[model samples]
Every structure is written in structure tokens, then in C-alpha cells.
Target: MVEAAAPAASVVETVAETEPPATASAPAVVASPAPSAPAPVARPAAVEKPVKPKPEARLYRSRTLGQWIKRVVLLAVGAIAAAAILILAARGVTTLPGVPEFLERYPGEYHLPATAEPGFPWWAQWTHFLNFFLIVLIIRSGYQVRTQQKPPAFWTPKRGGKKISINLWLHQSLDILWLANGLIFVVLLFASGHWMRIVPTSWEVFPNALSALLQYMTLDWPVENGWVNYNSLQQLMYFLVVFIAAPLAAITGVRMSEFWPKNAKTLNRIYPVEAARALHFPTMLFFVLFILIHVFLVFSTGALRNLNHMFGGTDVVNWVGFWLFAAAIAITAAAWYAARPIVLAPIAKLFGQVSSR
Candidate 1:
């Protein structure tokens, strides 16, 4: 009976089942590489400044070559140009065969022939004016040489191209003007203290300048900061030109004029008229040589800019003195250049070379 009941329970057992799944699933994701950093931004070009190199040694050369021939040609051309300027300035060209007959009527004293007329653009006020005034004054003062007839030291053709009297009025007037201008300028120079800036601050200016000159001769040094800077050699040269030549010009000028009769007599005691004449001749030659050398240096350095300093303006003189002249030159752009306050000028003060006004 127990076996029959267990078998009957198993016979009714049953279980439920599910159906199959549908479509395929999507592919697995893989990440893309990270973007690279941006390329570096390019830099702009820098400002370029011209640099001048130092000078070196030189070897000797002869004058017989084609270079000499070229030099001579240039010299001749310059001479011709100078002569033409002189001729044009004069009413016309007239050469005396010897001293003109009018010379005898005037005095036994000799007169060096004048090179050019008294006035012109380049030879204006300072150079030509002073010269003419001095010459005329001397001639007038020396009108009576041996006797009451003063020896006209300056040569100007009288009635018939005879060396004659000086124009005392014109001469003195110009002299006073010159003295005033000179005194005022000297004062300005001191007050402005521009001279201090120009005076050689160091001894190195000399030898270094000579080295620079030598380099310039060999083209070893190129233009730097504009013009070739002055070395000690240039310092000495300029000092001599300003202090020596200028003073000499003034002294000789006064000696010839009637301004200081006592001084003239004093000078005459030291040197007779003929000796003075000799001195004058040599001095004139020196001046001529100075001008030539000066022009050469100007061109070699930079012409227009150097010339510009002559005037207070920029158009004529582009170079604005040499690089070494930085302390000296003052033009319109000075304030802009210095990054200074724009105001009416008091030059040396800006440089701290002079006290404030």
C-alpha cells in the first residue's frame, strides 16, 4: 500500500520553458587619441642697429699709381670749383700783373692778395664777414705808414685798384658786433655748460681716436651709431681747432684792426710789420689747410649730419655731429630722443652736465 502512494505523486510533475532571443548586439566602443598641443607661435624680427668695428694697422703705399692720378683729378676739380666761387663773388676777375701802380701811392708795405670777396652764403657772418671786417680795419688803421700816410695793411683797390684806407665806421661797427656776439656766445656756452660737454673727459679719447682714424683710412671701421665716434686723437684735434685756431684767428684779427692801438703797438714791438705779415701769411695758410682737412673729415665721417649741427636745424645737416658728439648736438628731436619732458630748452641741464635753470 505505501509503494503505490509514492509512485502516484511523481506522475503529475511538470515545468514551464521560455522562447529564443532576437537580433545581434552592437560592437564594443574604442576611444580616439587625444588632440596634440597647438604649435608654438612664431616670434617677430628684432630691430637691427649698425655697428662700427675697431680700427687696425696699415701698410704704406706709393703716389705713382692710378689712385694718385684720381686724387690729383679730384684735387684739381676742387681747386677749380673754389676759384670759380671766388671769381663769381667778385664783380669780375682781374689779376694784377705785378702790384698795381696804385700800390706805390699807398705805401711801401706789401699786401697779400685776398682769395675771395667778403660775403656769401657759406662765408656769411662768421667766416667771411669777420675776415673782411678785420682786413678793412687793418688797412684803415695802417693808412699812414712811413709818415702821416698810414700803411694800409689790408688790401682793397682804391680809386684805381690801389690798396687804400679802411672803413673805420664799418670796421668798428662790425668789431663791436663781433665782440658782442663772441662774448654772448661764450656766456651762453658757460651758462649752458656746453663747453664742459665738449672738453675731453678722458685721455683715452686721443689714442683711440687715432686708432679710429687709422681704421677709417683702411675702411676697417664702418659707420657706427651714425658717424665715426671721436677718439682722443679727435679730441685733441678739435680742442686745438676750437681753442688754438680760434684764439689765433681772433688775436691776429684784433692786431690788424684799430680796436686796440696799444695792443697793436705792443704786438708791433714784438714783431715788425713785415714779420707780422709773414705770420699772417703762414696763419692764413694754416687756416686754409684746416678748412680742407675739416671738409675731408666731415665727408669721411658723414657730411650732411655734421653740417646740420652748424645750423640748429636738420635739413642741411643730417649727420648731427659724430656719434661722440651726442653730448653736444641739440636739435628739435632732442626731447623725443631723451624721452624727456617736452619744454623750452636749457640744454646742459638735460644732460646733468649743468645745473637747472
Candidate 2:
């Protein structure tokens, strides 16, 4: 029994020696990665404001009302003073050696037969009004054109060569109308036997006209018998206005027009443009003078009667002629004021391109 127990103990000891022994483990220690910076936030752009445009400038600013009034008053005073001075001087001059004899020798004559002729006819009245209207417009526009630095528009024909200013175009147009009217008046005057009233039939008219001038200068106004026969002075003046000034104005205007060939050196030399320009201005002045004197005489002699004779075709004094004359004057005033670039540009555009600077 002792030997079997010893063998069992020996087998247990051998198994223990062959097997590995176990041991205790510590907790693992690991560090985490650092946090990265937050991403940058984006900003919006700044806003901007808009800008405005500037206005265009003008060439010449017009004079004020006060300025014009002052000028007119000064002009009237100066004119009166000058005329008085001249007459006084002339009186003193007449006392000198040969002046008295010369004046006496040239002192004119006056003769008028008794006749009550029909005054201005209806056609004559209308034409006269038209002439006045056109002349006023022409003068006003001409002054504007002369003063203008830049043309508001230009006219280029389909068959184009040189371009013309809108104002010049208007001037030419008015001239054409005036010429046509004058032609018609001439025809009618001759056909209706009215030419005899203006045309000088006798050499004595010259002396008669000179006498009338002397009478006028002396302020002893001769009797006016226009219903039957115009004074020799009146006849001469009418003849000059109708035949001489009218044709001269037309000729000069044409010479300075675009229709005049610039290349025609020979023609230009014979009838120079400079000469035309000079004559044209003087002719316009003459017309203006005639109009002023004519108006003064008519009003001074007899307002209603003269107006009736020219406008109403009657010798009787009435308000009809005055009213018509007033209306005509009003229309002329309106036209004169309305002839600015703003009003004329559109009309000018009908013919060609109208561009403003």
C-alpha cells in the first residue's frame, strides 16, 4: 500500500513541473489628439450709390425786361435831341452865302385834281397784311441768324452739295413767298390800272417830290389826297420800294443763298457776295424806316380814316380796320416770340436732320 501511494505522488509532481505559471496585468494609458481651430466666417461686400448727369450750357443769355426798357427810353430821348440840334444847325447854315438861293430854287410844286377814287381793294388789303407779317418775321429771324454762333439744324437735299443752316433755310423760304406775292401784286396792279398811281408819268414829278420833302422838313405838312392821287413824293417812294428795293433785296438774297454757285468765280467777281451783303442790310434798314414813317403819317393824319382806307376798303371812319390791324399785329407778335429753336427745330426736321449742339 505504501509503494502505490508513492507512485501517485511522483506522477502529480511531474505534471506541475511541465505547466506555465499565471501573473496579474496593469490598465492601459493612451493620450487623445488635440482639437483643431474653428473655420473663419465669410463677410458680405459694401454697397455703392448712383450719380446724376449735368445740364448743357447756352451761347448768349437774353437781356432782362428792365434793360430793354431803359435802352428804348434812352434811344428815344437821344433821337429827339439830335433832330432838334440838326434843325437848329440847318437854320444857321441857311443864313450862310449860297444856301438860301439853292433852297429857293429847288423848292418843289404841288398839284392834285379833284377825284374820289376807290381806296385799297380787298385783295390789296390782304396782301398788304401778308407783306407786313412776312417782313416782320424775316427781320426778326435775320437778326437771330446773324447773332447765332451755332446752327440748330442743317438742310441737306437729296441732290446734296453744301448744307445750309435752318435759319437760312427759313429766310430763303420767306424770300420766295415774298417774291411770289410781289409778282402777284405787280400783275394785279397793272391789270387793275393801279400802276398809274405809283409810276411817274411826267418829268414834273421830280420837282414835286423835292417840294414835298421841303414842306415835310419845315413841318408844314402838305395836303394828302391819297384816295384820288398820291403826292409826287409818295408816288416816287412807292415806285422805289416796289421796283428798286424789292428787286435789289431779291438779287442780293439770291447771291448769298446756297443756290448761288460758289465755284462760279467769274460771276461772283462780277457781282460780289460782299457787295450783296452790304446792300442787303441797307435795303432792310430802308424798309424799316419807310414802315416807321408811313405808320406815323397814317396815324397822325387820321387813324380811323387811314386804317379804313388801307384795311376796310372804305373812306368812312370805323373800328373794323383798327380791330383787324390789332389782330394782325397780335399774330405777328406771337409769331415773333414763337420763332425759337424749340419751336423751329421740329419744323426744320421735316426737311432734314435737325440736331442741337
Highest lDDT: give the candidate number: 2
lDDT of 2 by residue, 202-239 (tens): 78788778667756665656677576677788889999
Q: Which stretches of candidate 1 lie over 4 Å from their true place?
A: 1-180, 219-229, 262-268, 271-275, 312-357
lDDT of 1 by residue, 1-357 (tens): 989887566554421123333336855557899999999999998999888886543422544456677888999999989766754543221124432333223221112123211111232224323443343343332332313333222233222232323323234334455556555545555554344333565554544554444444443443432222333445466567556765665576566554446545666788555554556546555656766676687666656665554422333444443432333334313422442222212331242222121
Q: Name the weakest run of 10 consecutive residues (lDDT summed) in model 2.
A: 109-118
- What TM-score number comes out for model 1? 0.38
